[model samples]
Target: MTADARPWTAPVAAGPVTATVRLPGSKSMTARAVVLSALADSPAEILRPLRARDTTLMADGLRALGTRIDTSDPERWTIEPGALRGPATIDVGLAGTVMRFAPPVAALAAGTVTFDGDPHARNRPLRPIIDALRTLGADIDASPSGGLPLVVRGTGTLPGGPAVIDASASSQFVSGLLLSAPRFAKGLTLRHEGPPVPSAPHLRMTTHMLRAAGAVVDESEPDRWVVEPGPTQGRVWTIEPDLSGAAPFFAAALVTGGSVTLGGWPRDSWQPVDTLTGLLTALGAEVTQNDDGLTVRGTGVLHGIDADLSEVSELTPVLAALAALADSPSSLRGVAHIRGHETDRIAALARELNKVGAGIVEHPDGLDITPRPLHAASFETYADHRMAHAAAVLGLAVEGIRLTDVACTSKTLPEFPELWAGLVTGS
Candidate 1:
């Protein structure tokens, strides 16, 4: 009973916008199919799975580590695997995928678990996955500012081999130790020394959903990753549609010149849909894809380019709100770790698109934007759901903007403001 900080005005479109938008599911493949179906061995079935709030706090932190899941079927949930015991406490609510994928499945739980969140999730970065889970043995206590209010102490297992980790500030610490490295005991190799793992397509969708839940994963040694422990064979796990939550309804068809679509979408997409269709076809947006999905029309001229969004960094706040309604300048470099996301999104998109008039500059990793003409202000959203989708694409075309919260778009499009006010009134 929380999310309603009020503010929220952002609606303004009323023009070209066509609209289709179905979106739901794939909050990064439902947090890696709820931590690979809670480290499956048999029972799985996750169908559509994306009931927001960061995949329902990663299935309630793997159901507080005992893992049963069920989720009463929004479309089918089911999980089941148990025996991952723990004195559990996990509430990773600000969810960087439940504080980096539920502390490596609570280090294969046995006793204590703990972990905390939402005070900006203790300045997010969890010391390179708590120093690679203490070099793969896992007894963790972290928080000498390493991040979060940690404590693992589990002793049922976890002695996964070779560690290393410097996931360049979060590739979810090499996908939270390769999604419980096949229930560890000597099943992980992992490498990545430093500086260069910025969402390489979410680590190739975490080694393609850990080789589709059967887990063998070799990755043929580039930044290294071996896996190989054994069991993990769950079964069904559909979830596709969220091409980065269809970037603000395809930036409402490129800021209202109009089309949208995004219905079934998935002509192959583990997210980062061809780098978001080549950054929305280099900001002019025509983006296609058939069988009733991915559309995004708006050629009402918007250009301004330079890109480099480090493997589509969560579509950098709706491509920095379509580069502040582009016409000319935009830079958006390789995302300096989105300044540890959920907040410093390039200094909150250069202080909320230069408080509406947009001229934005603040760069260390990105954002230059320069097309100024916009009016109306307010936009703050530091609670960041992509800064309330860059203040709802700068309120469609800047009217009154507003939006200090928009309930942080319920973490992952909890129906982002009634699907963006029914895509600007085409309701």
Candidate 2:
């Protein structure tokens, strides 16, 4: 569902975003919720599940594999798990949600199931978890480089074995193991044996969701988690709004001199949006809360902040947008995991922001962006949805910004352009 195909765009100084926007459900939560609900025996109801392309793909893929899913409502879904029949072929189509989460979820199916996806999905490294699942008696195989186009023959030949899995690169691997623990012949115990793993909060999110769906999770040690295998008892689950997706607007409220309200955002969310409220406040923004939402108003020239976003790395683009208007340099750390995204985000930011006349430096772990005068230009999103969404937010701070492949945001936000239109009160 791509929108607005104009020849090109010159970035315009964005009007203060004062609209009361209701952000979408967490794609992360939505995808995992679908898998958990599908793995159970009873009917499952998920409220406010993300309905964007990635999550919808998860639902469709699971349904194609013989599970019953009803997603007639944009905000919710009903998942019914039952008998698995036939050798199923499923396509996830660049949806990391379907690719990473579905494989383990598919292990629960009784017949042979083959998983294939688009080029980007095929490129992501899945060897660590694949190796771990193989250790636990899963019959799965990947290409020579552990790329996708994976083939998983079903549970009939399921093995019961144990091995340590390295989760240093991405948390999805760990979450996959945790989500499908019950299906494994013998429940899996993972050993984290590298630099502290990335996206720890997302890992926590998955574990918390699994427990909510009725799984036993053990994290008795600092770097280890042991999951006991059992069926997820179907129940009610609610997906929280994505704090990552709301970061750009929150930054807009801090620098654009107006209040922006976001509804359905919780006072207590694992998401990083509210945590940055202090950072926004420190940057000269006034924040207030109401019954249904939180609002922000900017007072003056924004100031830079020092922060760490290891678990909240999705906020990088928004932080970069604010740094462009701040008085000093902004430094953020714990972002090495971004390389696993559609594009190497650090490199993409350094390259693309430079096109807009910003002085930015890329680090192996994070980025250093210093505020500078802005220039108008078209930027490449490199087919990365986050990169595309980030470019649009940066457009708010300055003028003359065009993002190519803007449709990429469909991975999580298909109507971002429309949402922005509403936020800016533009047609």
Clashes of each: 0, 4
TM-score of each: 0.35, 0.93
Worst 10 residues of 1 by lDDT: 1-10
For candidate 2, the clash count comes to 4
Point out the worst 10-residue segment of candidate 2 by lDDT: 1-10
lDDT of each: 0.84, 0.75
Inter-residue clash pairs, candidate 2: 10-400, 11-400, 11-401, 137-159
Per-residue error for 251 in candidate 2, Å, reads: 1.9
Residue-level lDDT tens digits of model 2 in 1-427: 1254322242344566566778888888888888888887689999997788888788888887788999998766888986754388788877766777887766666777788876676777788878877777768878987868788877643443456777777888888878877656667677877877877778888888888888888888887787776677898878887767776667666666777777877766655555667767877788877677877787866888888777777777777767767899888778887777777788888888888887888899888888889877778877677777677767776666887666777778777777775665544
Cand. 2 Cα-lDDT: 0.75
Clashing residue pairs found in predicted model 1: none
